[model samples]
Target: MAWTRLLPVADLPVGMARTVRVGLDDVLVCRLDDQRVHVLEDVCSHDDAPLGDQEIEGGCVTCPRHGARFDIESGAVRRSPAPVGIATYPARIQDSWVEADLED
Candidate 1:
């Protein structure tokens, strides 16, 4: 796994997510709080729709298109309309920047 710097910690607002390009894939970088952050694939598991500009609560992100809730950390399915779980990456804050361990 290769760690890539996506953005600054200050750039990601708490309780929100930002989409970043990792190689040819779009990943969602979510900041749960000042100390916790998670990364997931940008697509919804239920449908082929993008997951962003949505609401996050209780460590899950609600898919805007179908309202499927997915756990940001473990990529677990938290709601219906999603037959599977999303893919999650290892994320951490390094030198005031958000870094994710993604495939290289």
Candidate 2:
């Protein structure tokens, strides 16, 4: 397991998601409630839409293209219109910076 620094914790606003290219993967890093961080595949399972540009509500993010809702923590497809689920990455905080590990 290799970890790469994504961004500073302060760079992400609460309840918002940001897109970062880690290695060759496009990952979405989200700052949820309680300043918890979640990292997931930026692509939406419904039609391969990027979730970084979508809208986030509560702990879920809605795909802007097809309106698919997914849980940021578990990568679960909470709403229909999307039958598949996206990949999730493990994240951690170190020295006020957010980092994520993805199997490449």
Candidate 3:
């Protein structure tokens, strides 16, 4: 897996989502808490809308375009209108930096 360092952990606020570019792919990085973070594809499966700026609530992210909500941890479609789940990348914090495996 090609793990790319996205940003420092301090740059990401807890309970918020940030969009980072790894090559041509746009990844949504959600910092759930002090010890957990999730990385997901920044696009909605249903309408191809950007999920970057969506709000993170209770481990779920609500798509701003059509109100489709997805679980940040598993990338599962929690609310309908989204027929499929989005892609999730493995993420880790090392040396106080957030890294995401984009190889998959």
Give the best candidate by lDDT: 3
| Cα-based RMSD of candidate 2 | 1.5
Question: Per-residue error at 42 for model 3, in Å?
Answer: 0.5
lDDT by residue (1-104, candidate 3, tens digit) is 77789989999999989999878878999999988989999999999998876558978998889899999999999999999999999999889999988885
C-alpha lDDT values of all predictions: 0.88, 0.84, 0.90
User: Per TM-score, what order, best first?
Assistant: 3, 1, 2
* Candidate 3 lDDT trough over 10 residues, lowest sum: 50-59
Best by TM-score: 3
In model 1, what are the clashing residue pairs, if there are any? none
* Candidate 3 ranges with C-alpha deviation above 4 Å: none
Ranked by lDDT from best down, the candidates are 3, 1, 2
Off by over 4 Å in 1: none
Clash pairs for candidate 2: none
Residue-wise C-alpha lDDT for candidate 1, range 47-67, written one tens digit per residue: 778897655788888888988
